[model samples]
Target: MESLKNLKVGVIGLAKSGLAAANFARSSGASVFVTESKQRAECAVFLKRLAKGVTAEFGAHSDRILESDIIVRSPGVPNNLRVLVQAKRSGIPVYSEIEFASRYISPREIIAITGTNGKTTTTSLVSDIFKTAGRKTVTAGNIGSPLADCVKKITPRTSVVLEVSSYQLEDVERFRPTISAILNITPDHIEHHKTMRGYIDAKARVFENQKKTDFCVLNYDDKKVRALKSLCGAKVIFFSAQRRLASGVFYSNGSIVVKLPFAGYSIALKLKIPGRHNIENALAAAAIAAAAGIKRGAIEKAINGFRGVEHRIEFTAAINGVEYINDSKATNVDSTLVALKAFEKPVWLILGGRDKGAPYRPLGSQIKKKVKAILLIGEAAAKIRKEFSGTAELLDAGDIDGALSLASRRAVKGDIVLLSPACASFDQFDNYEHRGRYFKNAVLKMKKRFEKK
Candidate 1:
């Protein structure tokens, strides 16, 4: 519902969010220009989608971003860029794509979910619950599509389930959700946010614009997340996997249960995914669904039918009595720690990639006790070897393929060769999925190689 007749909007980065924001702005009657740091040839295919009112500038001559009334930044782009600062100095605002898209959601509800991990699984679960409750739901943000791309599809009956990240929340001015949840807060994105406080502040912005009428679901087990209650203006509902909550969802002796503020009895739901972390995710999803007025039966049905997202401790193949697990989505120290707990075996763990400023020293205890040997790859290999060389047998395999082959050879019967690289994938592959696919392919290829022998 934002008026956009004569305004000129500059979209930073020629990525998916950038293209979607440009297209949306143009469709809303604004003159749009896209600025990408890459060369024109690098973005030739994406530029083909530009229409009459939209212009694109690629590479080198990119200070043109400051000429617009507002700047919409892509998720991974840093906010401290020279052009962004210059624009800020000139009184032009820089906002995330989610912030821009939220302005267009008039009558529909948005269930925005954020945290260090489990955002994707919890968001997908909530979306499925809404769909099972017979509501039109669209999944976006860090999960399905960019928030800007999902904007036009919003109707009065449609609800958006967004998996928001700290990067997206950093520059949000009015990106408030009707029902927001922070599943948990752990050490993540320190490379981008610079410090712990900066990261916490960014994640807390998801509920900054909420009113007393809105609802915010929080993780009761996470002290940092539980401490955010006073900061949120919305009615806070807590979800815990360890203890019984008098007013929210939790896990008891053997089942998932929930107790509403007024209910005399609690309801226990079924879960299809394993792992304690996933159970917490299910509980968090249930809290969000219940706060949004989704039926308890619908919630139980969605949780029962929900399978987990790919690349997070996903089984690739079993080769010669050895199991290869792909946890390519484990991009931080805490996530990798959770993945290690899922197995009770002699693990040949693969750990490396673009280091996110997380210390590998904290993971040494788990690696020493569980992992038989560790293969290091990507940019963080040396750093990981430094921290874990004393804890386990360390092998610098240099890259993913080399690491997988080395682990495959070392792995014996009942061994787990797990790829839980506690770092970002940009160091080697296009993204986490690409890295996960490569790991799976290598595992299958190794299996085939052994079959012929």
Candidate 2:
């Protein structure tokens, strides 16, 4: 294991991960050069700030990228990019941010969670469970802080709960987690992954390097995940909301029940989080916690007290007898379906953003059954509208403000104004969190306006 000292590295893309990689490279005594797509002016400005230690070029692939000893690619950059292809041809090693970060970190147990949906929630829940069980745990990776930044803080006993993306997993070599969970694989990141099989394969790599002692918690409800039970080398434990599992965790008689092979008895517990998806997430968290030898009592306590992460079914201000809910974190059709199923009240559903290539038919059907009216926003609005034309009352609001105003106006007593956009937020907002915060602020302002009236 060589330190990154004086290593000549090429960082492709000037995105957040690229910037983090650049900073990490400088801190580790490595010289870095950044490259970006020709059209991005923001990348040019970012390059100017790094004028002293880093160099940048646009449009055509720079020959200098091939000169580097190693190339650290941002998550957005594909492996098949011309520069990356050239690097491989020149025998220059290429790695993702996660791979680069993993090389520098000391060996510690990692609990990596990856899927099309519920990765964030499951990662947060698992981290909470570890904390409740009295373990030094920190949630990082794709969720918030880069794994490189948190790696130094981890002790041998510290549990690293990582929210890994398929992009991060794509280039990993020796990266292995003690507990790897693939929540549910759905069609997402299709633009990058190209095919559903590729996406599934990328997610499955979370468990690819796990040893026999390592645990792989899978979603038994998902056909794709259940099919991998025979392929994975790690000890397989399943969690499902729809079916009762013989050994692992399942929902039984309105309570979460965990039946482990060694325990000989089933532990029935209550959950604070609503929805079957959340129940599945809780079961996955509990499975991981129990595998790590955490007490059943502690696991039960954590699941019951866990209020869930913000921006996922987060209740905003109630104004004039109308309740506003922000589920901006539901960035996929499957996630929005779960959110819709959780609420029984007639919903004024605010939906749409940058499409992730998921089929909108199922969501349309769910909307037909669950939502009263649909408020459309962002680039995918028209597509969603077309899908749900006669299924539900579809209204195009064009933007978040317009959508919110319309939903607020249409919402009546006992009706829910829900912002659970079933697409990526990159079109109208910075990210899902930004979208969620804006929705909350708008709801608060509306509440204030009604109070003044």
Candidate 3:
């Protein structure tokens, strides 16, 4: 591990990852100074970090922070931020919170999962498998708690299942996983990454530091993820949702199955999570488990009983035969599109939130087929209306409650009301989970009102 003693480190942004990075740095004896772009009034969380005796600057990052030996930033903060760029020009290295955390933790196997959709599902499924096999494991990273927060949980017998993202991967210099999986790459976070090429490059970084002995799992059905075999030195393992592979896992005849050199197993569709996408996630998890030498029985037991992560297509309520689904976790176009594919019933889709650079045009055809009508809200509403002008019946419902109200009036008994906003939730709520819970609460109120009639 590199010595942090007496080194001056600049931590940019006071978000969860940044706070973790600062605390870890200070604990390691580094002279840590924190800078946040958000104002002091907005940083109640920052004050808690400041109580630890670390110096901090809020509202704007100062030019003086460039004097540090290195800079570590939150994943939500763009690397091209003026202060970070200035640090780069000054010859000081900039690192991701994940990268900095890896240095302090003991060497252990890391199974990192990343994709446009299904990251949390795959990461949690893999973690379940490892834990069920009686192996010690910690789940963190982009899924919920930052990797830096959970690194201390790692020990010689323990493993980490991390849900990484393009944002986190972009800053990684040597953040190699013992086994890494690229679930699938679709058009996402274009506003932050700038281009599809840039986004793909960032996702591919999970495999950048892998050795020939390491394993890189991939989605064979996704051409982009399939082609990633050429980008890394790690031994590649492909998992498919389509036809059976010679070596990897595949969905066949309503069952999840895999064929590898060690042993092969067929997992009946026992996962409580409904959808073809979840099946693919199960297969991906199985591939990671097989690579890690976890027994087939243990892998099968954990995955079959795995219900799923909350907020991603979570069922909220049923009122007068109409089902409500809170998929507020669908913060990107592809994610909403995938959620739409999971159901065959006519859908009343609630779409909108803070715009985050996802192109909405590709959703036109899918929206036409699956969605009966759309209730729009938040900053992305106007842009979505323009892109999907004639795709479906589009209505401007002012907010989450407004959208739920419209769905109650417009949706038929057999129809599904799906809250699958193809944009981030920052405009109307704290995050996707908050947006999802709020939607669920609204539906519960709607259910109570309907029952009283």
Candidate 4:
């Protein structure tokens, strides 16, 4: 490993990834300084975990950060932040935590997954497939753990399965993965990236550094994703849930069929996860595992055993034959559409959160066809209500609690009460996970009350 001795590093944000980056840099012999926009009280828990000899500042980014040789930014920090822009102008390099961590780990294969949705599930599934094949693997990046924390501890044989985000990809430089997969892209995160094209550009960066020897996995069902194949320098492998592929992985009838130039394999579908989106996710995972040299049987076994991830269409409970689903991770219109498509039962969908610059108009037809009611919550409730006012039974439910309470009263047998907010949860809760958990706990609490009755 190259020594970071005598180097000074500045880390922005004090969230999970930021703290990990600060600690990792300090341990790597770099003089680390951590800065966060949140006050000391807000970041107390994380600050307590900061490594010894690492100095920190809270509530602002100071000139101290500008003095560092390089700046490592958390995903939460905006790329165009004044301090970061100034640092770039001053000739100091700025990188996302993933990029910084990638510099230290060489000769280890990385399977990076990115898309508007299904990143976590696909990443976890890929990691599970690798483990089932008896390979050492670490799943990190946007799926909660930072790559920085995983790098030093991982051996040369370890396979890194990363759940990358557009934010993380925005600053990547010289960070090349052995294999990269773009599950599917839709109109999301436009608020941060400023335009749909900008969001697509950032997602495309996942495979930008790959060479002919590397593998790029493309989603054949998505035109935007399929077109990206031409931009990739690596050997392209297409995976599809919509059509059969003669040269890549695809879902055919009731099985996942793999048709590589060298060999062919197929696995029958017996997934515990619901939705066509998950079938796509499984296909993507299988493609990545196959590209990594994992056997088809191991890939099939892992895919069959995988149950799904939390906060993304997770089934909470069924009280009085009414099901409650927590899909708080559906923080965009496309995701909520996927949730709606997963169910045949009449849905009492709890929609709205902090708007992410996407419109709710696209959900109108689905809501009219499949929804019993629309319970609006969070900051985007008004905007959603405006677009969907007459499409279904509209409820001005203030938040998750109100939405669940209203749904419990109105929903009947065989109906679904879904918390699939088509917007970010920042306005109401800490994050999507917190929002999902709160919805789930409230549902469970209501279920217990039903038992007493």
Candidate 5:
């Protein structure tokens, strides 16, 4: 194997992926240079902290970047960008971090999970299920540790459970997963992919390099995911919460039942997580687990004990007889719809963030029926207010703290103050987790202050 020794690699965009690429290139004995569009004080401060050997130029320096042998395209940078175009014209190879990283590490078994929603939940659940079955499993890629970092530790017995994003899957070459899952495809990341079809195509690449011997677990309930049946070379296993399956997992009379081909008995299983979306997630996890040769009993045990991921319909605290729920992970309209469905009481929804280019009409209708009041904040606040004007009482808060204050004051007994932002968290916080933590902390402060009163 020819190591990427003394190779000149240029990283475009100074986001997490870009930084990871820079670090990876440095480790591989390559000289790294990073370029960013912003030359702000914050960016300058950040660039100053990079390795002394690594060089960085900010504010539209395409010429400096175009000189490198290989360009590591960060997910945030669009393909149509002038810098990428110049690199292409120069005949310089451009690859995503995942594609670049795959050249170094050798991993036998990879389980890649991609979807518009439930990717994190399914990936975490699948990894947990494999762990319960006493397998040496590590969950990485798009979730926490980058795939490159995780791949460096892969062994013969290690099963890599990767939560792949559309961006990561977009440029994969020979990076095939032994077990691939397309949980569901909805219109998401439109701002990045620029089109719904493009987003779907990026997700579909999870199975592009997979072999016939590999397994592709798909959501039978989602029509878009169901359409990929013909495209997948891997053996198809369907999972549904709404429909019954002859050889997969389904919901029957309030219990999850699985009917496998090898063992044709339906086991009445209990799930610790709430909501129909989670049931579908469990089914997906079970399908992956079963395909990985995990026993049914182990799957059931893991499902029974798994407490669900944080920031997804997470309960914060009850203050003044009102329940505060943090669902900052619902960054898209479809996810927010799921969160809205999970609630029975009148909801005081805290919505709005960096818009993902999804229409809010469907969400407006749901708010008209279910939501009592909405406290809007961040970049999409105006757009959200306009969309839900006649349907619900929309209040603009301008910030997360203001939203929390208004929501707490407006929420009545038995009513829910839900922070289910139907947009990306980039405008208000670091990410969804950061947004969720702030909401939780605000709720806690409000609880304590009310108690003192």
Candidate 6:
């Protein structure tokens, strides 16, 4: 591992990842300086979390940031930020927190997963599979905590499971994982990447640095993800949810079959997580575990016992015979489509948040067929309403609270009230987790009110 002794490091954005990076750098003997665009009062909590010697400037990115030898940018910060662009021109290296953290971890097997959807679920499953196989495992990256926070705990025997986003993968130079997987590439995050090709290119970077000895797990069902095989230097192992694969992991009949060189077995699809998307996610995890030389029994046992991560089509409560499903992690059009197909019951779907430049028109058919009403919320409400005005009943509830209140009144017995927003939650709450917790809490409160009635 490279030493950070006396290194002058600048951290951008004061979010969870940025704070972790600053602290990690400071503890490593680096002279760390943080810069956040939000005001001092706005980022007061994050400021309080900073390490003792770390200095920071809030409300702006001054010329002071340009003085550092290296810059560690948080995933939420745009790559094209003026200072970052200037830093690139000045020859001072700019790296994502994931890339910066990877430099500190040595002799560890890193398993990195990326895609528009199912990254968190697949990452969790992979971590659990590794742990079940008796390997020391740590889960981080885009799954709430930064990899920097857990790098100190990563020994030679450690298996690091990372849920890397396209944002995290953007600035990585030599950040290669021992086992890298691309679950599925859908049209999401266009607002940041600007185009479909740019977004795919960013996700593709996860495997760009892997050598021939490394492993690349891919989703064969997603044609976009499948087409990326030629670009990868790692040994490609494709996993499919749709058809039987001659090699790698695939779903055949009612079982998830693995046909890798190291292991071969089939486990029945008895996962707690619903939907074909999760089947793909499980297959991806199984393929990753198989590549890492984990035993068939451990993979099967982990897949079966995994209850799934929160906010991805999580069942919140059943009130007055109406079941509430919180899928606040469905922050894209394709994800919301997966959530809709996961259920057969009539759904009162809560849709819209901060728009990501993807059209809501693709969701029209599903809304017409399954959704009883489309409850609009956040900034994209008008755009969503315009697309599905005549396709289904549209309710402009404005936000999550109003949507739940309206759905509680209109939703009938045996129907589902699904919180599948199909857009980013930044408009309403801090993040998707916050939005999901709020919805789940509201549903529980609604249940109490129903009992009183």
CA lDDT of every candidate: 0.86, 0.83, 0.87, 0.90, 0.84, 0.91
Q: Which stretches in model 3 have alpha-carbon errors above 4 Å?
A: 49-51
Clashing pairs in 6: none
Each model's TM-score? 0.96, 0.94, 0.96, 0.98, 0.94, 0.98
Best by lDDT: 6
Span of 10 residues, lowest total lDDT, candidate 4: 381-390
Per-residue lDDT for 1-453 in model 4, tens only? 567787999999988888998999899889999988888998888877889999998888888899999899898687788999899999998999899998888646988999999999999899889999998888899996899988777878888889999999988998899999999999998889999899999999999999999999999989999999889999999998888877999998899999998548899999998998999999999889889888888998999999999888899999999999999999999999999999999999998889999888988878988999889898998888788766898999998889888988888999999999999999988889889889888989999999999
Q: List the residue pairs that clash in candidate 4.
A: none
Residue 92 alpha-carbon offset, candidate 6, angstroms = 0.5
- Residue 127 error for model 5, in Å? 1.2
lDDT of 2 by residue, 68-165 (tens): 99898888687788879988898888888888887776545788899888888888888888898888887888888877666567777777889999
Better of 3 and 5 by TM-score: 3
TM-score attained by model 5: 0.94
Candidate 2 structure, TM-score to reference: 0.94
- TM-score: which is higher, 1 or 5? 1
Residue-wise C-alpha lDDT for candidate 5, range 147-253, written one tens digit per residue: 65665577778888988889887767777788999999888889889888898889889899888899999998999999998998988888888978877777778
Please give the lDDT score at residue 199 for candidate 5: 89
What lDDT is obtained when candidate 4 is compared to the true structure? 0.90
Q: After superposition, how far is residue 312 of candidate 3 from its true place, in Å?
A: 0.4
Find the 10 residues in a row with the least total lDDT in model 2: 42-51
* Pairs that clash in candidate 3: none
Candidate 4 has a TM-score of: 0.98
